[model samples]
Every structure is written in structure tokens, then in C-alpha cells.
Target: MVCDALDLDNEEAEEEMYKLTRSFVNPHRNFEIPTTNQVFKMETGKNDVSLFPGQIVTVQIMPEVIQVSKKAIPVHIPISSPIRIILHPMFHQMTYSKAVQYLKDKSNGSYVVKPTPKGFGYIAITYIVEKDKAGVSVGLRLEVEGCKYIYSDLGELIVQYVEPKARRAEDLMAHAKFKSSVENLNSLEMNPNHSSYGFCFDYEMP
Candidate 1:
């Protein structure tokens, strides 16, 4: 008797699910998803460093060994995750320590420094002057060998990890527009030669 009652309950439940799905697909129904003209926005109350063309913004050297397969696409690893520990026959144990140390020694606090992971050292500076936005943009050119510099006409370069502090209504809207543009560039497939349209550094996926 209990088994029969359970079967009857299951059938009723399935019928209820089917009705719910049909209601969702009905064109006359309305959903509650919010719509926005804006796409991305910088965190409020952060400071901004005004950089200009030909200006240099120096940073500390940090290196990580990225693995590349047959096609040469960089194998991405999360920044929070520990690097893979490996042991090769020739070298009993291997870690990224050696690579990091090498770069640090080479940099030695130099303003003109090469980017780690090798061959990602070119810099591109751009000025954004759109009607809706205005700012200076800085980026790294990742598609060539050796070190080189280029100029662009894009808007401000907003680093995702950094906090931005611009409270003016115009600034907020412009920043939001700039953020969306950067995201669109970052979404493209890796192109070392002319990838200056987006961010040069790899980021940890949340």
C-alpha cells in the first residue's frame, strides 16, 4: 500500500514540474531580471594615478612559469592555487622559485624592466577621448619579441585588481564604459603580437 501511494505522489510531482516549465516559456509572461544601460563599474572611493603618454609606471617583478602545449596557448593556472610540484629525471625536484629568483636578480629595482614569463615586455600607451569618456590608457603589447613601445587612442587603463576613487557623476559613467571596453578585449583569444586592445596580465578567475 505504501509503494502504491509513493507512485501516485511521484506522478503528481512530475505533473507540477511540467506545468511550471510551460508557464516559463509562455511569451505573455514577464520575468524580473533587471536591465541596465551600463555594463562595468569601478569600485567607489579608490585613488587614481594620472598617467600620460611617454610616462612610465614601474612595478615590482613577479614571475610565474606558464606551460605551453603544441599550439602555444598559455596554460592558465589560478593565482590562489598552488603551482604544480613536479620531479623530472634530470632534476629531482622542480618549482617556480628558480624562475622568480632569476627575474628578481635581473630587475634589481630598475624602472625599465622586462615582464616575466618571457617575451611579454612591450608597452603601449593610449589616450581615450570619446564623447562619453575621457582618460589615459596604459597597456602591454604581448605579440612580439624583445622590448618595444607604442601609442594608442583608447581611454584610461583600469586595472581590475586596483581600487578606483572617482565620485563625480560623469567620472562614474565614463569609468563604467571604460570597464566594459576592457572586458570585451580580455575575452578574445590570446594574440601575442597585437593584443594591446586588452589587459596584458593574466588574472585569477573568481
Candidate 2:
């Protein structure tokens, strides 16, 4: 029975589109910046990237430890698997490619980085808009997959200086801003004014 169910489930998920995320608030509202961490320690004694919970970022799969043992034949293996790290890369136009290079370089030329057969790769590459507002970078932030390059600024999840304690009002406003981003993504998928990707975020509304 289990094997039969597995086959049926696979058949059901064969379709390209996910089951049209169903939610009353809208799918975009649910988009949260996935939890993230800094890829490397920086001079400032902090990790570089920042990601909110739920946002998605692609982390390359590379062989971390390559050991040449005393044995006649030394074997090397990767510590991690191909996965999208729930973090951000430094923003760059060719950030996707750079990311691939990072893995290639880090792995000492063990793996070749390329796009997965699935249209969407291990990582989801969605447009992240960070704008200057009142002397701060404020805009939509999420960890998604798609780029095959290493992002320098635009795409990477960067770590900024921690802000001093915000006043009650500031904190409230900050929370609202994040909520808005989620709402907007949900809205775009639902409305999808421009159908560039050949898929409409719209759903059959009852």
C-alpha cells in the first residue's frame, strides 16, 4: 500500500506548478525571508549575510574537507549536499554565477555547478529590492533560488550593522514593513500583471 501511495503522490506532483498555494491572506503574504547565517566571518567580527525566517537562499554543495590520508588511496567526500542555503549573498548582477564559482573554488574543483533539470534550481531566485529610505536600506527581502552566479550586492544577503535599540514606534513600523513585503509577493503571484516567466500567480478564486 505504501509503495502504491508513493507512486500516486509522485504522479500528482509531476505537474510544474505547485498546488497553487492556498491561503486567505494571499500567498505573497506568507513569503518570509528564510532564516540565514553568514557564510564567512568578516573583519568586523560578524558574519556577512542576513536572512529573515522563511526567506530562501541557495547554498552551494561543495566538498569541505579533502584529506590526503597516509593510505595509498585517499578518498575525498563532500560534507554537505546540494541545497539552497536559507541565507543571502552579497548583491551583484552576476551574483548567481559567482555563487557557483564559490563552490567550485571552495571544493577545489571537485564539483561542477549548473542549473538543475527543474526550471527552479535548488535555490529560488526572486527579485530582491533594497532601496534607500530615510538613510536606511528598506525594501523586500527573501531567500529564494535561481541564480547560477555569485551575487555581490543585489542578490547576496548582506549583514549590516546592528541598529541601536529602536524606540517602540520604530520597532512597530519595522514589523509592519516586513509584513508588507510578504503581502506584496502574495499579491504579485495572485495578480501577476506581467507574465514574463510564463506562469501566472493567479488562482481560481471561489
Q: Which stretches of candidate 1 lie over 4 Å from their true place?
A: 1-94, 107-198
Which tens-of-lDDT digit does each residue in 164-183 have in candidate 1?
Answer: 32233225434523333445
Q: Rate the local accuracy (lDDT) of all candidates.
A: 0.29, 0.29
Residue by residue across 91-131, what tens digits does model 2's lDDT show?
22334455454444232212222233343333222221122
Please give the TM-score that candidate 1 achieves against the real structure: 0.12
Candidate 2 residue spans exceeding 4 A from truth: 1-89, 107-139, 143-206
Q: Among all windows of ten consecutive residues in candidate 2, which has the lowest summed lDDT?
A: 1-10
Q: How many clashes does each candidate structure show, in the order listed?
A: 7, 45
Give the best candidate by TM-score: 2
